[model samples]
Target chain A: MQKKSWNWNRFLACSEENMRNLQLQKLLERNSMSRSIEIERERETDGTKGCCKMEKGSSGYISEFLGSIPTFLRRCLFQVLSFGPIPHHIAFILDGNRRYARIHHLEAGMGHRYGFLALLSILKYCYELGVKYVTIYAFSIDNFKRKPDELQYLMDLILEKLEVVLSEENMVKQYGVKIDFLGNLKLFPEPIRKAAEKVMAATAQNNGTVLLVCVAYTSTDDIVHAIQGLYKEKQARIQQTAEGKQMGDDDEPVECSGGSNLEEFSVSSADLERHMYFAGYPDPDILIRSGGETRLSNFILWQSTFCLLNNPKALWPDISLWHLVWAILQYQRVRPFFEKKKRL
Target chain B: MGANRNGDDVTEINRIHLVGFFPNDLFQITSSWRLDIWNLVIRLCWFLLHQVFNTVHIMMGIKRVLESYFVPSGLLDEYKDLQLKKLRYLAVVVDSEEALQTLRIIKLLQWLSAIGVKHVSLYDMQGVLNKNKETILRSLSNSRLWEESHEKATFLNGGKMTLEFLSISDGREGIAKAASYLCSKYMKAKTLSGNQNERVFTESDVDIALKAVGCGGPEPDLLLIYGPARCHLGFPAWRMRYTELVHMGTLKSMKYGAVVKAIHKFLTVRQNYGK
Candidate 1:
C-alpha cells in the first residue's frame, strides 16, 4: 500500500510537469506569432508610397488580434485578483532615473521623460485596478542640489509634461483623474508653479482618482510644516479669545467667558493630522520604491506605520504593469497579519 | 540610378515594383525566418538554464534549512567576526506567532551571547516574549553556559551582556503617555501666561513633553526583523526613524549567513541623515 501511494504521488507530479510544459509551449507559439505580426507591420511601414493605407489596415487587424489575448488573460487574472482585498492607496518612491539613463546611454533629460511615460502607464493601471489614491515621489527637496543644467532640464520637462497632461482632455474628463500637487508649491519658479496650479484647478472637480505628485517634499519637512500650521492655529485661537475678552469688557459681560478656558488648551494627534498636507487621504497601504533601494529616503514617514515596503530592483523607467500586480499580490498575502496586528 | 544597357532593364525594374508582392524573395524570407528561429532557440535555452538554476537554488535552501538545526563552528567564528564592529545596541523583532517558542528564544539569546552582542532587545508585536521574560531569564541563568563566571563569559572582550524585552504595548502606551503629557504642559503654559496673544509654544515643548514622559529611547543602530513578511510589524516608529531595518527572512529558517550579511551591510552603509 505504501509503494502504491508513492507511485501515485510520482505520477501526479509528472502529470503536473507535463501540463506546465504544454502551457509554456502554447504561450511561446502565441508570442512568436505576435512577434511576426509586429515585424510585418514594421516592414509595411518602411515600404514605398502606396502601402500606407494597406499598412494601417494590416496594423489595425494585427493589433485587434494581438490585443485580444492580453485582454482575455487580464480579465481572467482580474477576476482572481478582485476576489482578494485591493490596496486603496499606493505610494511610489520613483528612484534611479539618472542611473537608468546612464545604463541605457541616453541623454540627460530623456530618462526622466521615459520615467514620466512609465508613471502615466502605472497610473492608468492603478486606476483601472480600482486603486483610488496614487502618490508618487516625483521631486524631492534634496533633488535641487543636482547640477544646474540638469535641474533646469527637469523643471522644463516637468512643465512640458504637465501642460501635455492638462491638454489631454480624455485623461481628465474620461478617467476623472484629479491631479494634485502635494508639496510646497512656492518652492517652484513662477511659470512652472503657475502651470501646476492650472493643472490642479483644471481637474479640481474630478473624483474618480487622486494623483498626488510630491514635489519639493520630504517627510521631515512635512512634519515641520504640520507643526508650524498647528502653532499658527493655536496663535489664532489665542488672538480670537483676547479679542472676545476685549469685546466683553466694552459690552455687558457674557456668561461664557473665553478667558477661563486657557487651562483647556491642548494639542491632539487629530489636530496634527488635520494640519497635514495629506490629511484627507488614507495612509498608503503599500509603499513601493523602485531602483532596488530598501530605504524610505524620507518619503511619507509618519503615515507609513503599517505600509508594506516593496523594493523591486528595477529602475523607475523600467517599471511595468506586472510590478504593480505583484505588489498587490504581496499586499494580499500580508493583509491578514496587518489586520491582526492592528486589532491587537 | 545605374545606367541601364537596354530598355529591358528599365522594364524589369518597373515590373519588380509593379508586382508589389515578392513571393520569390527567398533571401528576405529565409533571413527573417532564421532570425525568428534563432530568437526562439535562445529563449528556450534561457528558460531551461533558469529552471536548472532555480532547482539548484531550492536544493541549497533545503540544505541550509537542515543545517540550521545545529550551530556550526564556522558560523560561530563568522558571527564573532561580525561583532568586531562592536554594535552597542541591537534589536531583534520576531513575529508574534514565532515568539511563542520559548526554547527558540533561549537558543537565540545564547547564540547572541556567544557572538559577543553586548546588549540585545527582543521584541514581538504581541507581548509573548514580555510575558515569558522571567522564565527566559531564569532558564538562561540556570543553563551551564550562562552560569559561568562573569569574567570568563563576558561579551566581546570584557563587558557582560544584558537583555531587554519589548512589545507593541510599550510603544503604544508610551505614545499615549507622551500625548497626555503634552496636553497638560500646553494647558499649564497657557494658564501661566496671561498674554494669550503671544505665541508661546515652541518645538522644544513637544520634545520636553516626550522626554518628561520617558517615551523616547536611544535609537537602535540596527534592527533585524525575523518574520514571514518584510513589514516592520508596528515596531516603535519614533525609535526607528534612522534605524537600518534589515529583514532576516522567517525565524524558522533563520540562517547565520543572513545575520552576518545584515551586519556587514549595516557596517558598510554611510547614512547621510537626509542631507
Candidate 2:
C-alpha cells in the first residue's frame, strides 16, 4: 500500500491501537535492553534449574556492572516514573490474618501476632521509602462482637504486640515513628488500652513517621467521632464568645473559628479536616486492601482522597517484601499521572 | 578419540545450518557514512501508514484492550458529571468518635452537598454519643444543616443504640445488628410483610423490599465505603446491593480528593448488576 505523510496531531489523537503500538514498541525495546536482568530475576528463585543457561561471569558480576550506572541517573528515572508527591501516606486494610493462619494450620491468635510482626516490617520499609504516614486496620469497632474467648485472645495478643511495639529497643523507637490509635479505644480492656496508650506516648516525640493503628476502629465510627469533635469545637467557640462578655441574649448567632459567618455556621471541608482523628497527618496516598475480595470494608472514610489503590489477591499476614515491591512498582507506574494532576 | 565419536552429530548440525543461503551481507551496513536516510524515511512512512490502517481497521479489538487497562481521561471527565448528578448516599462508618468524626463527616457531607449531592448519612455502628457528644454540639450548635437534618441525623450513644434499630455499640454485635437492621429497615421502607410480630404492608414483600430499599428503588445509588477490606463487609445490604462501592483506605491517611474521585467513579459506572 502507498504510504502517507506523518502528522503529529494525528499521532497524538491516534486511537488506542496506535497508543498500544507505541507502548508495545517501548516494551519490546526495554525488554531487549534488560533481557539479562529479566532472565536473572526469573532464575532467582529456581536458580539451579537455569544455572547452566547463565552467561560467562557470575550473577554478582552482572549486578556490579548494573550498579555502576550513576545513582543520580537511576534516581532521575525513578522520579520520572514514581517519585515525590508520592503517596505521602499509605493505608493497609490488613485482612485475612486468621485465614492466612488457618491456611498454614496455625492458631488464630498466632496468626494475628504474625500479622503484627509483618506490619512492623512493612512500616520500616515505608519509612525507608520516605512515606510519611501509615495507617493499619488493627482491629474493628465491630470486632467487639466476637465471642468472649476470641476477644480475650485478641486483646492479649494486642497487648503483647503493643508492649513489643512500645519497647524502647523496638522499630518504633529505632525509626522515630509517631503512633496514634484510631476508633474507639474506650471499649478496650484496661491492659490493652494502657498498652496502646504507652505505645502512643512512647512514640509521641518521634515525628519522623506517622503510624495510625485503627484498633477498635471503623470508618463510620471515625466519621461520627469527627462530627463529635466538631461539636465540641463549636461549643468551645460559643463559650469563648460568652465568656468574652459578648453574649447577646437574643438567641443571636455566634462567630466561630476563621471568621466563618455565624448565621450560616456551615463547616467547610478544610474546617472539618482540622477536627478529624487524622487531623495532623496527610491523607493516604495509596490504599491497599490485600485479599482475594475487592472492597473497602469500613476503613478510612475521609482521608483517602486522591489515593491510588492496589488490591493484591493476598491476605494480610501473607503479604511479604515481594508484595510490597509489586505495590511500589504499581505506585511508581501511576505516580506520574497523579503528579501531573497535582501540578495542574 | 571421543571427538571422533561425535563427528557425525557435529556434521549433521553444520549441514542444517548451511542448507539454505540467508540474506545478510547485503543488509549489513556497518558504517553510518553508508546509511540511507531518504530510503529509511520512505520505509518509516510506509510502516506508520500501515499501522494507522491496522488501527482503524480493528476498532473493536483496540477498544477491548484499552478498556481492560486504561479508563480514558475523557471518561473520567464524564465520571465527574455522573458522580455529581447521581443521587449518592455515602455511609461513613465510625465507632466511638461518632460525634468527633461527625464534624469531618459533616464537612465531607457539606462538600458533597455544595456539589449538589443529595444524601450523606454518617452511619455509626458503635454509637459514638459520649466523647463525640461535645464535638457534635460544638460543630452544629449554630449550624443550619444541624437544624434541618437534625431529625435525619442525630447523636446516639450506647443507651439509645438498639440491635433492632441497627445501633451497634461495638464491632462484635455489629454484623447481626447490621443484617437485621437492613432487613427490617428495607422491609418497612418498601411496605413489605414483616414477621408474625409485624404487619404485611405490601404484597410481594420480598420483591417490594428489594426494589424499594434493597437492590430496587430507594437503593442508595452509590455506596463509597471507606475502611479495612475492599468489601463492604458491614454496610447494610439494602443499601449496598446495587450501590457502586469505592474504598477510601483508612482515616489517618484520608485525602479530600479521593472522596471526590470515589464518588466520581461510582457515578460513571454503567451497570447496576443485580444485588
CA lDDT of every candidate: 0.66, 0.50
Worst 10 residues of 1 chain B by lDDT: B1-10
Q: Candidate 2 lDDT, tens digit per residue, A244-329?
A: 64545536443432233333444444554565577777767778877644445556644543466567778886786656655555
RMSD of each: 17.9, 23.1
Strongest candidate by lDDT: 1
- The list of candidate 1 runs beyond 4 A from truth reads A1-59, A147-149, A245-266, B1-89, B116-122, B126-209, B268-275
**Model 2, residue B245: C-alpha shift (Å):** 4.0
lDDT by residue (B1-275, candidate 2, tens digit) is: 01111334433332222121123453343243333342344335434433454465358445534542343344445434543545534455443232344556546555554555554444444445333444543454232322233343332211121111122332223222322333335334332342334232221343343334223223355555444323333334333333445555444445455556566555554541210
Give the Cα-based TM-score of candidate 1 against the true structure: 0.69
DockQ of every candidate: 0.07, 0.03
* Model 1: colliding residue pairs: none
- Docking class for model 2 is incorrect
Tens-digit lDDT track of model 1 for A64-138: 699558645653444334435668999998887878878866667767866776776677567546688999988
lDDT, candidate 2, equals 0.50
